[model samples]
Target: MSQLTIVGLGPGPRQQLTAEADAILQSGQPLYLRTQVHPLTADLPAFTSFDSLYEESADFADVYNGIVTRVLATLADGPVVYAVPGHPMVGEQTVAKLIPQAKAAGHTVRVVPGVSALEALYASLAIDPSAGLLILDALTVTPETLQPTLPTIILQVYLPRIAADLKLTLLERYPDDHAVTMVQAAGDPDVERSETGPISQIDRLGWIDHLTSLYVPPTDETVEYEPDGESIDGMVRLVDTVAYLRSPEGCPWDQEQTHKSLTRYVLEEAYEVVTAIEGDSPDAIEDELGDLLLQVVLQSQIAKEAGEFDIDSVAARQAAKLIRRHPHVFGDQVADDSETVLVQWEEIKATERAAQARVLDGVALALPSLVRADKIQRRAARVGFDWPDVQGIWDKVAEEVTEVQAAITSGSKPAIQDELGDLLFAVVNVARYLNVEPEEALRQATMKFTERFHRMEAAAKAAGQDLSAITLAEWDRFWNAAKGR
Candidate 1:
């Protein structure tokens, strides 16, 4: 039977290689090294290394495939030994692809383990991986892949450009000055080197190479899952609190509520958040946002109880959608400005929607009437269904007003209501054309009127008169005085 042996060269020096791995290397069978870049490769038996493939191939995938093809072809010559740095299973792409292909071809496979780079990294940095560790490949690192609160090690930062890109992605979740350690030739006594510095300066280092790996210690300032799972962070604790509140042993009101019963509170909490934002009160904004978040958590909990979906799945879906839509950030597509971003965003959303879905289909029906009107108008405008100019919208508003007046004069209640709605819709279009938010404009107008009415009531009270009993003329006088003030 054909045989293929895969061996690890340990992290560094031949001394670190396991006795079993040493025996396999000394078996004197045809030897192949994944790469000759490791420090101990020179001390090993004569072998062919794939170092040239790294320069010839366009990407790591291509190089890995090329290595696997060559290694499998060599099996026709009887037994073969393949060696890789660190460990055959850890961060070694070629070995992973080679094993299954060799096995399918009826070759017996043997894997000899060696000390992995992660083990070396742990020793050099004096960190314990049992606590919590996230290992990431530098080439595929992105903002979404990082968990700032966990101890992380990024491998294969072999080039300055990769390090630079990794630095930017890390900066999204970590402070620019967060301390990170870079270890090279980790377990080799003669060449091992470690440097500690701010993450922002990692790309500026002069000695990065194929053997380099970075270590980032855990931080508690950010909200993320605890490794032990015994304790919860603020957000997770809130989720637990909501779960408890809805449990049989909890609050009567919370336990009795269903998703449908809590719909109004969702809307109310959202409006309160908007009000707090408009009021420019940070504390109120924080409190109101917490209330709004409760609605989401509660809805997710209700769905979970019904065997639907939980909050984590909800967040995962949203994150996936965001990453998919944002090609400029997560992919290669370029968006130079916000307008370009919006166009790209809509294009991506259009692809996600069903072919028969209308342009306004995704707009929430539960939104305030004015806001809903604005959203509907904007959706139509995107597809060129809008009036050519503000003049046309204004003319339409005027026409609706005339029809409303005629309906009122004819004493037709339904006709009057229909025309009134048309007039309001036309007005909303006018606001859209002028780039104004109709809901916010109406809110401000209503607030202004409320303030003036309050002043009028105060004036009437000071004069010892009841506002309800005041004549129209007196009302106008007080109203005008309040408006003037």
Candidate 2:
């Protein structure tokens, strides 16, 4: 295989260029300069007549791609000398592309390292990139894509025009007050470093070029998490966590759960946790919240096992729902008041449910019937299918009760059962109209009745007359006494 040499020209002149790099440059098989714009390139002791031609390219990608093409072409002839400004390993775009391509094409690629911008910048400032450093091409990266990094070296800040664009993009994700230091042609006789506050003002200093690089120190505090799982280095998707929980390698209990099994626990934990939040104990809520999240996590684990959905799907679907329903946040649809927000929400929810073949569906069937009924009734009431007020619902309930009583008097079981159900349904409407949860209200009523019945039993027991043996009149007296009737 033909040898493809990658040579670093250093940040400045031949004096700074390492001996190994000089040997590669003098090899004379064929010399290709990645770019001639660096001060070090112009400072080459002797002009290499066969340097790579890149200046005529319209863009950086074109120039780099062309360099790779030329490098491959040169390798077919024999050995080649490919030179780039700064270290061959540091932010040299052509080398980054060429090294892999040459070897992939069966050509042997050799890298000859020399002084990098990072080395010169570090020495000049007495700092170490080892503390934490990031490098990027000034022509490509936006401020938003940059991870908050320490001792960042932004290379290839070719011209004033590119620097200005980079500055604006930086402002979007970083504060205007972010400090940036510019190092130009470090180690050159005309070497310069400019320290500036405000990313906006840094562009005004415009002596930046292909030889220039910026050093930004570490940004903020880092929060660490449980590292017992997968690679602690990467940004773990929530789905990955769910996958672990569901996988054969994951938790045993979590793997055993199903949607049907988790339903009751989900409801119980959610209500108890919501109660903590409403009770105004943020501390209690925090613990209970973890419990609530366990339910969601466990459910997601089960879904993943079943090949249905996972945590990410659940979160993404809910996130999309909020954005879609609220349109005001993610879109241009205006909602000035709570009323308007609610109206938009209802309309959007209805549309979505209709798409799911259930326009009027408010709650899942898995919910208790009473709570589900209340939710359905409230949703319908918002659109005007409700009693005007509690008084109207009370009248409807009373009317149903009279029908029930009349049915009872007729001594017809089917009629009485039907009428009793209607009376209860009407009572539910009255409870809804009164702004009460019918289920909770009925629970309290039943508990009170049980207590009163126990009081009557106690009073009868104290009388020393067995209730079963007592005359009708005596039993009546004791029952009245017990109940204060």
Q: Against the unseen true structure, what C-alpha lDDT does each candidate score?
A: 0.85, 0.70
lDDT of 2 by residue, 1-485 (tens): 89887888888867888988877666555776765666656545444432344446533455677778877887888887888777888876678888898899898877888888777877876786666667777645644346654556777676665565566556544666777777777677666656657676766774765666666555663222334534232223343455466555688877666677788898999878966875689899988987888788777655543435555567768998788887987899998899999888878877776755443554778777677777877777867897766888888888998999999999999999999878877777778887899988876687677777788778878766677788889877776775674
Model 1 Cα lDDT, one tens digit per residue, 1-485: 57999999998888889999998898899999998878777778799998888778744556788999998889998999999998889888788889889999999999999999999888888888998899998855655568887999999887765676577667656777889898888988788998999989998899999889999887765433343434435676676678678775679999777788999999999999989998899999999999999999999877655545667778878999999999999999999999999999989977886564577788898989999999999888978998877898888989999999999999999999999999999999999999999998999999899999999999999999999999999999999999999
Cα misplacement distance, residue 84 of candidate 1 (Å): 50
Clashes of each: 0, 0
- Model 2 is weakest, by summed lDDT over 10 consecutive residues, at 230-239
Clashing pairs in 1: none
How well does model 2 score by local distance difference test? Answer: 0.70
